[model samples]
Target chain A: MTVNRQIHLVSRPQGEPSAANFKLVEAAVPALTEGQVLVRNHYLSLDPYMRGRMNEGKSYAAPQPLDAVMIGGTVGEVVDSKNDHFKVGDKVVGMGGWQEYQLVDANQRGVLQKVDTTHIPLSAYLGAVGMPGVTGWYGLVKIIDPKPGETVVVSAASGAVGGAVGQLAKARGARAVGLAGGPDKCRQVVEELGFDACIDYKQHPDVKSLSTALKEACPKGIDGYFENVGGIILDAVMLRANAFSRIAMCGMISGYNGEPIPMQYPQLILSNRMKIEGFIVSEHMEVWPEALKELGTLVATGKFKYRETVADGIASAPEAFLGLLKGKNFGKQLVKLI
Target chain B: MTVNRQIHLVSRPQGEPSAANFKLVEAAVPALTEGQVLVRNHYLSLDPYMRGRMNEGKSYAAPQPLDAVMIGGTVGEVVDSKNDHFKVGDKVVGMGGWQEYQLVDANQRGVLQKVDTTHIPLSAYLGAVGMPGVTGWYGLVKIIDPKPGETVVVSAASGAVGGAVGQLAKARGARAVGLAGGPDKCRQVVEELGFDACIDYKQHPDVKSLSTALKEACPKGIDGYFENVGGIILDAVMLRANAFSRIAMCGMISGYNGEPIPMQYPQLILSNRMKIEGFIVSEHMEVWPEALKELGTLVATGKFKYRETVADGIASAPEAFLGLLKGKNFGKQLVKLI
Candidate 1:
């Protein structure tokens, strides 16, 4: 029998999570059920949303109970299969939790096709080719529905979701502007992602200056605002949104770190005649096949690219997750297991 | 030449306007130029939005400059006509400012139809049958699209716009809840306006209690929200919005008194996967005829009713406007010159 080392939730976090919030424990792996497959986790995804799950509060998803295993998505290989769908040797991705080994239902796992790594790395599936990639694409194309000549602004532009959104907007012939925390990320967004302009939000002292820069970048004002960091940036953008502006509310990373909620700019909204919509990727699962197909082709042809900040070992997962919340991760933060 | 007495903006108000901010100036009426018709103001419309125009700040409309006649919509009689569209003795509605007499372009005025005041008061055209009526109708039918059996919440529910919105939503078979400032207004909303429930926000003390009461009254979560007051109340309603909920942003009377903008519950927006849209009635002018035709029929059938709080004399217009901002006006606030 194989043993599984799992990171369990030791306590709920009041604000920012720490190493003490998690406890690593080992347990003997149970025999797989008739419809289950044994998976050895290769890469664990560490995202900002996990922080919300760690806290005991009302949110979109259920909070992680104390002493329960910390939940996450994992890219793994099928070590042994008791189900006909997944064979031993098949690579898969599923909600495998923060564990070295997990016995998951065959229906829960998505089979990953072996592709030529020369064109794109396998880790691209976790970044540009994965959930974050689909999130940005769907949020911009489906929710925002930006016109060709319209200006599109995205927060966290160098990160996984924002970078993809900016690139996708560019691909659709929309003028793309990005807001990033640092100069290097801003430069990368403009140079690498081919955004029209990038705003270094960290260097900008106030939202007023950010608004001025944003207005200068897009003289026509923002037509589509893909919001990832919702706080002062959102307030500033709302002030300058053009008539019929569409705002896609994806994530609010700025507020997730336990800051006071920002003031509602209902006046700006009423005056501008804007539409602000919130969306979750899982809600559009029916059309995801088509989206994934398009995204997969883009990555295969080198049209779309991504970056990964992979932390070594399961012990570093919490640190990586905290770093992602702090914007330390250049792209998608992942923990690799040997 | 008929001399016109105009209320001019002496100075912009810092927070709320007092009698000192306005100056009643009697000036000699200018000779009617080509294409200009001389008009005698009969009834002036006093609205809360006029408060924004009084200030020297960026808004949907240009600010009222110092010493300039305070801007407003008015029902006037054309004393002399230079343009072919209007003739002497024809009653019309135009942007005539707060004045006794003025020179206007014939192209700028809408010809008011002479109707029987016995059935429906002529002032109803300026109140429920005019801009406020269209504002509520369009915002409800087009923007919010309140579904049958769905719960709808309207802020400032006893006022001109909110009252009309609640009535329209009720007409559409939606469960309507009204949020008003006083117990009298709340009673009027439920009994007269036919709202399913009413919340007297003044007595509630805290928005959380109101929210709980609103949820208890709604049972089924709110699907549409017609917002006129944007403060903590909006934040509270946002928290109870269900998936695919639509918020039609009408006005923000709560913040109009120069109160600091209230904190937003943007996280609730994402969690609920909601949509909030802001619209101006002017943008939907093409569809106005359809809405007006329906509203006219409703008025004629006595299915939809309106109440006007007429503050007699042009001098009382500023006080009426101040009363509107303070939620003292039970229904549509109007200034009668006759």
Candidate 2:
């Protein structure tokens, strides 16, 4: 019998999560039933969204259960199966949680989707061609709906979702501007990600200073914005937005740790006549096939270039997740449990 | 020749507009050339949007120019016409400003349009069948787009746009709820305007109390909110909003006069997955014909009822407008000039 190592949420954090909040454990893999599949998870995605799930307060999602396997997205190959669909050595993507192995009921349709890892890497399914990529596609195509020659701005430009948003906007013929925390991330956003311009937000402290930088970068004013980090960045976007702009509110990672992030200039929404919409990517399942097709083509053809930071094992997930919240991880933060 | 008595913006208001900000002056009506028409203004509309025009700050529209005739909507009779489309005794509505007589060059296509007041009264054209009515229609229909059986709420519920919004939502088979300033207005909203429920916002001091009242009134939670008053009312609506609720941000009248109205809980937008869009009514001319047809039919058939608080003469416009800002004037505030 295989011993499956896993991470569990030991406790909920008040402000910021630490190592004390997670516990690593080992459990023997249960024998697969007639319609069951055993997936040995290769890569586990550590996302900013996981932080919101850690808080006990009423949030976008239900709080991550204490003393349980930390809910997560995983891409791996099936090591054992007693099911008709999933066979041994078949690669698949599923919500395998923070564990070395997942016992999935293959009878469930959407629970497991077999992915072809010939041209695309197995880890890419957890980044560019997966949930994060689909999020970017939805915000750009459905919400922002940028036209050719329009200026599109995105926060957290080095991150998986933000990078995809900027690149996709560029593909639509819009001038894509990215806001990244450090000079290194800004370099990656501009040179690596193919954005028209990348603003190093670390140079500016407040809304006024950042707005000046944004104004220089987007002389015609911003037509669309895909927001990841809120607070000062959102305020700057509001100040510099063109009339009739659209803002896709994705995440407020800056204030996710029990901080009050009030929108300072909501009147600008009226003055600029903006459409600000917040959405969950999972709720919009209809667009996944199309978004994935586009994203898959982009990655397979080498049009979509992404960076990844991989931690060693399932035990490293907590530290890696904390780093993601602090903008420490350069790109898509993942735990390589293989 | 007729003497045109006009009110000019003598000075911009610091907090609120007082009599000192406006100057009542008389000028000789300009002589008409070919394709020119002289309109003897009957009713000068005193709307909340006009208050926004009184400020010198960079706002939705261009700042109401210093020492110029105050911009307004007017419904009146044509005394003389040199145009092919118009004749003497034609009832028309146009941007006539704060003046008794207007010399309009009829060649300007959209500056003037004739209205039939056979069943619908001339003053009704300024309220229920005019810009205010269309403002409600566009916000509710285009932005909110409330589904049947869903609960739709409107702030400033006794006012022109708010009243129309509630009635229109009801027309679409949705439960219409309202937030008015006082007991009298709340009573009018429920009894006269036919809202499902009405909450007297004056009874509640802050967001918590108002939100409690809103929760009780909308037990099913708010599916859509048409915001006219901002600050406390907007905060209350945000607290009581359901998942995937849509907020049509029409006006922030409460904070129009240089007060900061920051959004308190933008996190709720992400949690609730809300869509908040701000718009100016005039910018959407395509929906005017459809909106007017619906409103006109409702008013003509006696299915829709409206109240008017008319201040006598063009000189009364400034005080009437100031009263509107304070929520003192009920229903469609107008200045009757004959």
Candidate 3:
């Protein structure tokens, strides 16, 4: 019988999670029931939203139960299967938790076809060509519905979701502007992603000045805003929103750790007739296939690109998650298992 | 030659406007040019929006210039006509300002048909059937779109716009709740305007308690919010909004005086996925006829009712306006001049 090494929730986090909050333990692998497939994790995705799940609070999703295995999405290979749909050596993606081995229902897991590494890296499924890619696609196409001449701005521009948003918006013939933490990421976003402009928030400390810079980049004012980092950046972009502006709020990474900043100029919302909508990616799971298909095509054409900060083992997952919160991850953060 | 009695803007107010801000002067009325019609003022519509016009600050409309006639909409009778469409004794509505006599372009003014006073008073056009009525109607029907099972809440529910909003929302089959300053106005809102409930802010010092009361009245949570007085009331309502709630931001009368009380809850917006949209009734004037037709039918059927605080003569307009700021008016505040 195969033994599974799992990281379970040791304790709930107060503000930012630390390694102590997680405990690694070896447990006996359960027998595969009917319609279940055993998975050996190849790569586990570490996301910023996991920080929210670590805390015991009400959110779009329920908080991870105390003492339960740490919840996460994973790319794995089917080692054994009782289900007809999944066979041995089948590559799959599912909520496999922070575990070396997991038994998931075949219907609950997605069978990802083995992609040619020469064409596109297998890790793209965890980053640019995966959930993050689909998140950006759904927001840009479905929520924002940006027109050809309109200007679109996205925060966390070099990160997985924001990078995809910037490229997709550009693909739609809309002018794309990005806001990143540092100069290097900003340059990478503009030069590599083909965004019209990028604002480095670290160099431009004044929010109003950054807003003016963004306005200069987008002379007509922002028509669509794909918000990932929310805080002063959100406050800045809000000032430059034109009438009938659509703000697709995907995540509020900036304010997740701290107390929320009081909105300074909400009257702008009244004056500009702006529409801000917040949504979790899972809420649009049914329409995810459409987003994935489009994203897959873009990736296959080499028009879309993504970076990953992959940790060596499951023990490094917490550090990778912490790095994501600190804006240290260039794109998607992932934990690789041996 | 007709002499015109004009009220000029003397000084901009620091806070609540006093008599010192206005100066009344008499001037010989100019001869009507081509397309100009000589108007003798009859009824002047005093509204809260006029307060914004007095301040030398940014708003939807340009602020009144120093020493210029205080701008206002007036129901008047055409004394002399130099235009083809208008004739002597023709009742019309135009931007006549605060004056006894004025000359306006006939094309710039709308002809006001003299309706049966027995059916509804002529001044009802200034209140329930005019700008205020249209403001409430458009905000509720177009912006809020309250469903039958939805809960609708309006601030300043005893005032012109708010009273109309509560009544219209009730007619549209939504549970209506109002927030007013005093207990008397709160009682009047529930008893007269037929609101499901009314919260007296003065009596309920704790905003959270007031919110709880509003929540109890609206068990399903607020689906549509018709905001007139912004600030703490808005803060309370924002907390109670369910997912996909719509806020029709009409006026922020609470913050009209100067800087508002600093708001402490913007995270509620991201959490609830609420939408706050600001609109001016004038923006959707094309749909005015349809709104008026619906509102008129409601009034005719005795299903909708309106109350007006009529201040006799033009001199009382300032005091009435100040009273409106203090929530002294039971409904629409008007100045009747003969």
- For every candidate, the chain B TM-score is 0.94, 0.98, 0.93
Please state the error at residue A277 of candidate 2 in Å: 0.6
DockQ per candidate, 2 decimals: 0.59, 0.81, 0.52
Best by lDDT: 2
Model 3 lDDT tens row, B1-338? 66677778889999978888888777898877898888788888888888888898666788999998888877778889898887897766666788777787766545333333456556777778778999999999998998897899998898889988999888889999998888888889989889989988776566687778777877888999998877777888877888878888888887777875444666666677666678888888798899888877777777787888888877777777788888888888877777
Ten residues in sequence with the least summed lDDT for candidate 2 chain A: A54-63
In angstroms, give how far residue B139 of model 2 lies from its true place: 0.4
Q: Can you write out model 2's per-residue Cα lDDT over A38-116, one digit (the tens) per residue?
A: 9999999988889889888676678898999999999999998999888999999999999999999999889999999
For model 1 the local lDDT of residue B5 reads 80
TM-score computed on alpha carbons, candidate 2: 0.99
* Model 1: per-residue Cα lDDT over A41-160, one tens digit each: 888888767887887767778888888778887787789888887788777677778889878776643533323345556566667877888889888999888889999999999888
Task: Evaluate candidate 2 and give its CAPRI docking class based on DockQ.
Answer: high
lDDT of candidate 2 over B1-338, digit per residue (tens): 57899999989888877989999999998878999999999999988888788777677778889888999999999999999999999999999999999889999999998999899999998899999999999999999999999999999999999999999999999999999888999999999999999999889998899999999999999999998888988889999899999999999887877788999888788889999999999999999999999999999999997899999999888888888889998899989999
Question: Which of candidates 2 and 3 reaches a greater TM-score?
Answer: 2
What class would a CAPRI assessor give candidate 1's docking? medium
Can you tell me the CAPRI class of model 3? medium
In candidate 2, how many Å is residue A48 off? 0.9
